[model samples]
Target: MIKHIVKDTFILQRLSSVATENDSDIVKDLIDTLEANKEICAGMAANMIGINKRIIAFQDNGKITVMLNPEIIRMSDAYKTKEGCLSLEGQRETTRYRSIKVKYQDTNMKVKIKTYKDFTAQVIQHEIDHCNGILI
Candidate 1:
Protein backbone atom coordinates (compact mmCIF):
# COMPACT_ATOMS: atom_id res chain seq x y z
CA MET A 1 0.00 0.00 0.00
CA ILE A 2 1.13 3.55 -0.82
CA LYS A 3 0.87 6.28 1.77
CA HIS A 4 1.79 9.98 1.67
CA ILE A 5 2.79 11.96 -1.40
CA VAL A 6 6.00 13.57 -2.58
CA LYS A 7 5.69 17.27 -1.82
CA ASP A 8 9.16 18.43 -2.74
CA THR A 9 9.13 20.90 -5.57
CA PHE A 10 12.46 19.73 -6.93
CA ILE A 11 11.25 16.17 -7.43
CA LEU A 12 7.93 17.28 -8.93
CA GLN A 13 9.88 19.66 -11.17
CA ARG A 14 11.56 16.84 -13.06
CA LEU A 15 10.02 15.75 -16.30
CA SER A 16 8.55 12.30 -16.99
CA SER A 17 7.83 10.12 -19.98
CA VAL A 18 6.44 6.72 -20.91
CA ALA A 19 7.47 3.77 -18.80
CA THR A 20 9.66 1.47 -20.83
CA GLU A 21 9.36 -1.65 -18.64
CA ASN A 22 7.30 -3.15 -15.82
CA ASP A 23 4.26 -1.12 -16.70
CA SER A 24 1.89 -3.47 -14.94
CA ASP A 25 3.20 -2.51 -11.54
CA ILE A 26 3.16 1.16 -12.42
CA VAL A 27 -0.41 0.89 -13.63
CA LYS A 28 -1.42 -0.84 -10.45
CA ASP A 29 0.18 1.84 -8.36
CA LEU A 30 -1.46 4.58 -10.36
CA ILE A 31 -4.85 2.95 -9.97
CA ASP A 32 -4.35 2.43 -6.30
CA THR A 33 -3.29 5.99 -5.68
CA LEU A 34 -6.09 7.40 -7.74
CA GLU A 35 -8.66 5.26 -6.02
CA ALA A 36 -7.34 6.26 -2.64
CA ASN A 37 -7.47 9.93 -3.47
CA LYS A 38 -10.75 9.92 -5.35
CA GLU A 39 -12.56 11.88 -2.67
CA ILE A 40 -9.76 14.44 -2.36
CA CYS A 41 -9.05 15.12 -5.99
CA ALA A 42 -10.56 14.74 -9.42
CA GLY A 43 -7.31 13.75 -11.14
CA MET A 44 -3.73 12.82 -10.44
CA ALA A 45 -0.50 12.04 -12.24
CA ALA A 46 2.20 9.46 -11.62
CA ASN A 47 4.68 12.13 -10.62
CA MET A 48 2.27 13.49 -8.04
CA ILE A 49 2.92 10.29 -6.10
CA GLY A 50 6.68 10.39 -6.87
CA ILE A 51 6.64 8.04 -9.90
CA ASN A 52 8.16 9.67 -12.92
CA LYS A 53 6.01 8.15 -15.64
CA ARG A 54 3.65 9.55 -18.22
CA ILE A 55 0.47 8.41 -16.55
CA ILE A 56 -2.61 10.26 -15.26
CA ALA A 57 -5.90 9.21 -13.67
CA PHE A 58 -8.95 11.46 -13.55
CA GLN A 59 -12.57 11.28 -12.45
CA ASP A 60 -15.26 12.75 -14.67
CA ASN A 61 -18.92 12.49 -13.90
CA GLY A 62 -18.30 9.78 -11.30
CA LYS A 63 -16.16 7.69 -13.65
CA ILE A 64 -12.44 7.26 -13.33
CA THR A 65 -10.24 7.13 -16.42
CA VAL A 66 -6.55 6.44 -16.60
CA MET A 67 -4.28 7.45 -19.43
CA LEU A 68 -0.70 6.52 -20.14
CA ASN A 69 1.62 8.54 -22.33
CA PRO A 70 -1.10 11.04 -23.06
CA GLU A 71 -0.45 13.83 -25.51
CA ILE A 72 -2.52 16.66 -26.81
CA ILE A 73 -2.67 16.29 -30.56
CA ARG A 74 -4.87 19.27 -31.25
CA MET A 75 -6.12 22.28 -29.33
CA SER A 76 -8.65 24.99 -29.99
CA ASP A 77 -9.08 28.31 -28.24
CA ALA A 78 -7.19 29.18 -25.12
CA TYR A 79 -8.70 30.31 -21.85
CA LYS A 80 -7.11 31.55 -18.68
CA THR A 81 -8.36 30.10 -15.44
CA LYS A 82 -7.28 29.20 -11.96
CA GLU A 83 -6.65 25.55 -11.06
CA GLY A 84 -5.29 23.70 -8.06
CA CYS A 85 -3.21 20.56 -7.62
CA LEU A 86 -3.11 17.98 -4.89
CA SER A 87 0.69 18.01 -4.94
CA LEU A 88 0.87 21.71 -4.39
CA GLU A 89 -0.64 24.35 -2.20
CA GLY A 90 -3.30 26.75 -3.43
CA GLN A 91 -4.27 27.49 -7.03
CA ARG A 92 -2.84 29.67 -9.76
CA GLU A 93 -3.69 31.05 -13.14
CA THR A 94 -3.47 28.47 -15.91
CA THR A 95 -3.97 28.86 -19.59
CA ARG A 96 -5.72 25.86 -21.08
CA TYR A 97 -7.48 25.02 -24.28
CA ARG A 98 -11.24 25.03 -24.36
CA SER A 99 -11.07 21.73 -26.19
CA ILE A 100 -8.36 19.28 -27.05
CA LYS A 101 -7.72 16.06 -28.94
CA VAL A 102 -5.57 13.64 -27.03
CA LYS A 103 -3.89 10.35 -27.85
CA TYR A 104 -3.00 7.96 -25.10
CA GLN A 105 -2.66 4.35 -24.10
CA ASP A 106 -4.89 2.36 -21.78
CA THR A 107 -3.73 0.10 -18.98
CA ASN A 108 -3.75 -2.83 -21.43
CA MET A 109 -1.54 -0.76 -23.76
CA LYS A 110 -4.26 -0.15 -26.27
CA VAL A 111 -4.06 3.15 -28.10
CA LYS A 112 -6.97 5.57 -27.82
CA ILE A 113 -7.79 8.94 -29.28
CA LYS A 114 -10.36 11.17 -27.73
CA THR A 115 -11.44 14.78 -27.53
CA TYR A 116 -12.40 16.66 -24.41
CA LYS A 117 -13.97 20.05 -23.80
CA ASP A 118 -14.78 22.36 -20.91
CA PHE A 119 -13.89 21.11 -17.46
CA THR A 120 -12.73 17.68 -18.59
CA ALA A 121 -10.25 19.27 -20.91
CA GLN A 122 -9.05 21.46 -18.09
CA VAL A 123 -8.41 18.47 -15.86
CA ILE A 124 -6.50 16.64 -18.58
CA GLN A 125 -4.35 19.65 -19.37
CA HIS A 126 -3.49 20.04 -15.70
CA GLU A 127 -2.38 16.44 -15.38
CA ILE A 128 -0.40 16.59 -18.60
CA ASP A 129 1.39 19.59 -17.16
CA HIS A 130 2.41 17.43 -14.24
CA CYS A 131 3.88 14.86 -16.64
CA ASN A 132 5.82 17.72 -18.19
CA GLY A 133 7.08 18.89 -14.80
CA ILE A 134 4.80 21.93 -14.61
CA LEU A 135 3.15 23.03 -11.38
CA ILE A 136 0.17 25.37 -11.60
Candidate 2:
Protein backbone atom coordinates (compact mmCIF):
# COMPACT_ATOMS: atom_id res chain seq x y z
CA MET A 1 0.00 0.00 0.00
CA ILE A 2 1.15 3.52 -0.73
CA LYS A 3 1.63 5.60 2.44
CA HIS A 4 1.44 9.27 3.15
CA ILE A 5 4.78 11.08 3.00
CA VAL A 6 6.08 11.95 6.46
CA LYS A 7 7.13 15.56 6.87
CA ASP A 8 7.84 15.66 10.56
CA THR A 9 11.50 16.41 11.04
CA PHE A 10 11.39 15.09 14.57
CA ILE A 11 10.28 11.72 13.32
CA LEU A 12 12.61 11.81 10.34
CA GLN A 13 15.57 12.73 12.53
CA ARG A 14 15.23 9.68 14.69
CA LEU A 15 17.75 6.95 13.84
CA SER A 16 16.32 4.00 11.96
CA SER A 17 16.80 0.55 13.36
CA VAL A 18 18.07 -2.50 11.49
CA ALA A 19 15.50 -4.18 9.30
CA THR A 20 14.75 -7.87 9.52
CA GLU A 21 12.76 -10.33 7.52
CA ASN A 22 9.69 -9.28 9.46
CA ASP A 23 9.98 -5.78 8.03
CA SER A 24 9.36 -7.04 4.51
CA ASP A 25 6.06 -5.20 4.53
CA ILE A 26 7.92 -1.94 4.89
CA VAL A 27 9.95 -2.71 1.77
CA LYS A 28 6.74 -3.13 -0.17
CA ASP A 29 5.36 0.10 1.22
CA LEU A 30 8.53 2.01 0.42
CA ILE A 31 8.61 0.73 -3.15
CA ASP A 32 4.93 1.46 -3.57
CA THR A 33 5.34 4.97 -2.22
CA LEU A 34 8.38 5.61 -4.39
CA GLU A 35 6.51 4.51 -7.50
CA ALA A 36 3.54 6.67 -6.56
CA ASN A 37 5.80 9.71 -6.32
CA LYS A 38 8.19 8.85 -9.14
CA GLU A 39 7.23 11.87 -11.16
CA ILE A 40 8.77 14.17 -8.57
CA CYS A 41 10.96 11.92 -6.44
CA ALA A 42 13.81 9.55 -7.26
CA GLY A 43 14.24 7.89 -3.89
CA MET A 44 12.64 7.39 -0.47
CA ALA A 45 13.67 6.16 2.96
CA ALA A 46 11.60 4.18 5.39
CA ASN A 47 11.46 7.22 7.68
CA MET A 48 9.83 9.15 4.86
CA ILE A 49 6.77 6.95 5.35
CA GLY A 50 6.69 7.18 9.19
CA ILE A 51 8.52 3.90 9.70
CA ASN A 52 12.04 4.25 11.05
CA LYS A 53 13.58 1.19 9.56
CA ARG A 54 16.78 0.80 7.55
CA ILE A 55 15.07 0.45 4.22
CA ILE A 56 15.15 2.54 1.05
CA ALA A 57 13.60 2.31 -2.39
CA PHE A 58 14.81 4.27 -5.36
CA GLN A 59 14.70 4.54 -9.12
CA ASP A 60 17.42 2.46 -10.75
CA ASN A 61 17.55 2.75 -14.51
CA GLY A 62 13.89 2.12 -15.38
CA LYS A 63 13.01 0.11 -12.29
CA ILE A 64 12.74 0.55 -8.53
CA THR A 65 15.29 -1.10 -6.27
CA VAL A 66 14.98 -1.74 -2.56
CA MET A 67 17.77 -1.98 0.00
CA LEU A 68 17.36 -3.25 3.51
CA ASN A 69 19.82 -2.14 6.22
CA PRO A 70 21.99 -0.31 3.69
CA GLU A 71 25.42 0.85 4.80
CA ILE A 72 27.92 2.82 2.77
CA ILE A 73 31.17 1.00 3.28
CA ARG A 74 33.24 3.21 1.01
CA MET A 75 32.74 6.46 -0.82
CA SER A 76 34.90 8.62 -3.09
CA ASP A 77 34.84 11.68 -5.34
CA ALA A 78 32.81 14.03 -3.17
CA TYR A 79 31.10 17.10 -4.52
CA LYS A 80 28.65 19.68 -3.28
CA THR A 81 25.08 19.82 -4.56
CA LYS A 82 21.63 20.97 -3.59
CA GLU A 83 18.72 18.62 -3.08
CA GLY A 84 15.03 18.88 -2.25
CA CYS A 85 13.02 16.30 -0.38
CA LEU A 86 9.36 15.51 -0.65
CA SER A 87 9.29 15.78 3.14
CA LEU A 88 11.05 19.12 3.16
CA GLU A 89 10.02 22.54 2.00
CA GLY A 90 12.95 23.54 -0.22
CA GLN A 91 16.34 22.66 -1.51
CA ARG A 92 19.38 22.41 0.75
CA GLU A 93 23.09 22.29 0.00
CA THR A 94 25.06 19.21 0.98
CA THR A 95 27.98 17.05 -0.02
CA ARG A 96 27.51 13.91 -2.07
CA TYR A 97 29.78 11.19 -3.38
CA ARG A 98 30.18 10.43 -7.04
CA SER A 99 30.81 6.80 -6.25
CA ILE A 100 29.93 4.54 -3.35
CA LYS A 101 30.17 0.89 -2.38
CA VAL A 102 27.34 -0.24 -0.13
CA LYS A 103 26.58 -3.24 1.99
CA TYR A 104 22.94 -4.06 2.30
CA GLN A 105 20.39 -6.83 2.43
CA ASP A 106 18.01 -7.58 -0.41
CA THR A 107 14.28 -8.13 -0.15
CA ASN A 108 14.96 -11.75 0.69
CA MET A 109 17.29 -10.70 3.52
CA LYS A 110 20.43 -11.80 1.72
CA VAL A 111 23.49 -9.63 2.14
CA LYS A 112 24.87 -7.96 -0.97
CA ILE A 113 27.58 -5.46 -1.76
CA LYS A 114 27.33 -3.21 -4.77
CA THR A 115 28.98 -0.13 -6.24
CA TYR A 116 27.06 2.83 -7.57
CA LYS A 117 28.11 6.05 -9.24
CA ASP A 118 26.86 9.44 -10.35
CA PHE A 119 23.22 10.21 -9.64
CA THR A 120 22.45 6.73 -8.38
CA ALA A 121 25.21 6.95 -5.82
CA GLN A 122 24.03 10.34 -4.69
CA VAL A 123 20.51 9.08 -4.19
CA ILE A 124 21.74 6.13 -2.11
CA GLN A 125 23.85 8.40 0.06
CA HIS A 126 20.91 10.67 0.74
CA GLU A 127 18.69 7.81 1.81
CA ILE A 128 21.42 6.29 3.98
CA ASP A 129 21.81 9.63 5.70
CA HIS A 130 18.12 9.50 6.48
CA CYS A 131 18.68 6.14 8.12
CA ASN A 132 21.39 7.73 10.23
CA GLY A 133 19.08 10.54 11.30
CA ILE A 134 20.96 13.14 9.29
CA LEU A 135 18.87 15.54 7.23
CA ILE A 136 20.17 17.84 4.54
Candidate 3:
Protein backbone atom coordinates (compact mmCIF):
# COMPACT_ATOMS: atom_id res chain seq x y z
CA MET A 1 0.00 0.00 0.00
CA ILE A 2 3.01 2.34 0.31
CA LYS A 3 0.68 5.09 1.34
CA HIS A 4 1.53 8.67 2.18
CA ILE A 5 2.37 9.62 5.74
CA VAL A 6 -0.45 11.09 7.78
CA LYS A 7 0.40 14.35 9.52
CA ASP A 8 -2.91 15.28 11.06
CA THR A 9 -2.22 15.51 14.78
CA PHE A 10 -5.83 14.83 15.68
CA ILE A 11 -5.73 11.68 13.61
CA LEU A 12 -2.32 10.62 14.89
CA GLN A 13 -3.51 10.93 18.46
CA ARG A 14 -6.09 8.19 18.01
CA LEU A 15 -5.08 4.71 19.11
CA SER A 16 -4.74 1.80 16.71
CA SER A 17 -6.09 -1.75 17.06
CA VAL A 18 -4.37 -5.10 17.20
CA ALA A 19 -3.63 -6.59 13.83
CA THR A 20 -4.46 -10.19 12.92
CA GLU A 21 -3.25 -12.86 10.51
CA ASN A 22 -5.50 -11.38 7.86
CA ASP A 23 -3.34 -8.25 7.94
CA SER A 24 -0.22 -9.91 6.67
CA ASP A 25 -0.38 -7.94 3.45
CA ILE A 26 -0.68 -4.66 5.33
CA VAL A 27 2.36 -5.51 7.37
CA LYS A 28 4.29 -6.34 4.23
CA ASP A 29 3.32 -3.09 2.65
CA LEU A 30 4.42 -1.20 5.72
CA ILE A 31 7.75 -2.97 5.68
CA ASP A 32 8.28 -2.13 2.06
CA THR A 33 7.40 1.45 2.60
CA LEU A 34 9.62 1.73 5.62
CA GLU A 35 12.56 0.27 3.80
CA ALA A 36 11.98 2.45 0.79
CA ASN A 37 12.04 5.52 2.98
CA LYS A 38 14.65 4.36 5.43
CA GLU A 39 16.68 7.49 4.80
CA ILE A 40 13.98 9.66 6.33
CA CYS A 41 11.97 7.14 8.30
CA ALA A 42 13.69 5.05 10.93
CA GLY A 43 10.46 3.15 11.55
CA MET A 44 6.78 3.60 10.92
CA ALA A 45 3.42 2.74 12.40
CA ALA A 46 0.59 1.50 10.21
CA ASN A 47 -1.41 4.55 11.12
CA MET A 48 1.36 6.76 9.78
CA ILE A 49 0.80 5.26 6.38
CA GLY A 50 -2.99 5.58 6.60
CA ILE A 51 -3.69 2.06 7.89
CA ASN A 52 -5.35 2.16 11.27
CA LYS A 53 -3.94 -1.08 12.57
CA ARG A 54 -1.48 -1.70 15.36
CA ILE A 55 1.59 -2.50 13.32
CA ILE A 56 5.12 -1.16 12.95
CA ALA A 57 7.97 -1.72 10.52
CA PHE A 58 11.58 -0.81 11.19
CA GLN A 59 15.07 -1.36 9.87
CA ASP A 60 17.64 -2.99 12.10
CA ASN A 61 21.14 -3.34 10.67
CA GLY A 62 19.85 -3.24 7.11
CA LYS A 63 17.16 -5.82 7.82
CA ILE A 64 13.52 -4.96 8.11
CA THR A 65 11.29 -6.39 10.85
CA VAL A 66 7.60 -5.99 11.40
CA MET A 67 5.74 -6.08 14.69
CA LEU A 68 2.00 -6.41 15.02
CA ASN A 69 0.19 -5.23 18.12
CA PRO A 70 3.41 -4.45 19.90
CA GLU A 71 3.44 -3.64 23.58
CA ILE A 72 6.26 -2.88 25.94
CA ILE A 73 5.81 -5.35 28.74
CA ARG A 74 8.86 -4.22 30.70
CA MET A 75 11.04 -1.15 30.62
CA SER A 76 14.21 0.02 32.31
CA ASP A 77 14.63 3.42 33.85
CA ALA A 78 13.71 6.30 31.58
CA TYR A 79 16.33 8.46 29.97
CA LYS A 80 15.95 11.60 27.93
CA THR A 81 16.77 11.34 24.27
CA LYS A 82 16.08 13.15 21.02
CA GLU A 83 13.64 11.55 18.61
CA GLY A 84 11.74 12.48 15.49
CA CYS A 85 8.85 10.89 13.63
CA LEU A 86 7.63 10.51 10.07
CA SER A 87 4.46 12.25 11.12
CA LEU A 88 6.08 15.15 12.91
CA GLU A 89 8.67 17.75 12.16
CA GLY A 90 11.93 18.24 14.05
CA GLN A 91 13.41 16.19 16.83
CA ARG A 92 12.50 16.76 20.41
CA GLU A 93 13.64 15.52 23.75
CA THR A 94 11.58 12.51 24.80
CA THR A 95 11.90 10.20 27.77
CA ARG A 96 12.33 6.55 26.91
CA TYR A 97 13.77 3.39 28.37
CA ARG A 98 17.29 2.34 27.52
CA SER A 99 16.05 -1.21 27.35
CA ILE A 100 12.65 -2.81 26.90
CA LYS A 101 10.95 -6.17 26.86
CA VAL A 102 8.24 -6.27 24.21
CA LYS A 103 5.54 -8.75 23.33
CA TYR A 104 4.22 -8.60 19.81
CA GLN A 105 2.90 -10.76 17.02
CA ASP A 106 4.93 -11.54 13.94
CA THR A 107 3.59 -11.23 10.41
CA ASN A 108 2.24 -14.74 10.81
CA MET A 109 0.42 -13.67 13.95
CA LYS A 110 2.62 -15.75 16.18
CA VAL A 111 3.35 -14.07 19.49
CA LYS A 112 6.98 -13.35 20.24
CA ILE A 113 8.79 -11.75 23.13
CA LYS A 114 12.12 -10.00 22.83
CA THR A 115 14.27 -7.54 24.66
CA TYR A 116 15.74 -4.51 22.90
CA LYS A 117 18.50 -2.21 24.08
CA ASP A 118 20.26 1.02 23.15
CA PHE A 119 19.29 2.63 19.84
CA THR A 120 17.10 -0.25 18.77
CA ALA A 121 15.24 0.00 22.02
CA GLN A 122 14.71 3.69 21.44
CA VAL A 123 13.44 3.18 17.90
CA ILE A 124 11.00 0.49 19.03
CA GLN A 125 9.80 2.70 21.82
CA HIS A 126 9.16 5.54 19.40
CA GLU A 127 7.15 3.35 17.05
CA ILE A 128 5.25 1.77 19.93
CA ASP A 129 4.25 5.20 21.05
CA HIS A 130 2.78 5.73 17.60
CA CYS A 131 0.80 2.50 17.90
CA ASN A 132 -0.54 3.79 21.19
CA GLY A 133 -1.39 7.16 19.62
CA ILE A 134 1.21 9.01 21.65
CA LEU A 135 3.27 11.61 19.80
CA ILE A 136 6.86 12.39 20.67
* Model 3 Cα lDDT, one tens digit per residue, 1-136: 5777899989998989878889988887898788778898778899898888999988888788899899999999799988888788998999999989999998878899999998888999999898888999
Q: Candidate 3 lDDT (Cα, whole model)?
A: 0.88
Question: What would the TM-scores of all predictions be?
Answer: 0.93, 0.98, 0.95
Structure candidate 2, residue pairs in collision? none
Please rank every candidate by lDDT, starting with the best: 2, 3, 1
Clashing pairs in 1: none
Best by lDDT: 2
The global Cα lDDT (0 to 1) of model 1 is 0.86
Among these predictions, the greatest TM-score belongs to: 2
Tens digits of per-residue lDDT for model 2, 1-136: 9999999999999999999999988888898899999999999999999998999999999899999999999999999999998999999999999999999999998999999999999999999999998999
Poorly placed runs, candidate 2 (over 4 Å): none
Q: State the C-alpha lDDT per candidate.
A: 0.86, 0.94, 0.88
Model 3 scores worst on lDDT over the 10 consecutive residues at 27-36
Candidate 2 RMSD to the real structure: 0.6
TM-score head-to-head 2 vs 3, winner: 2
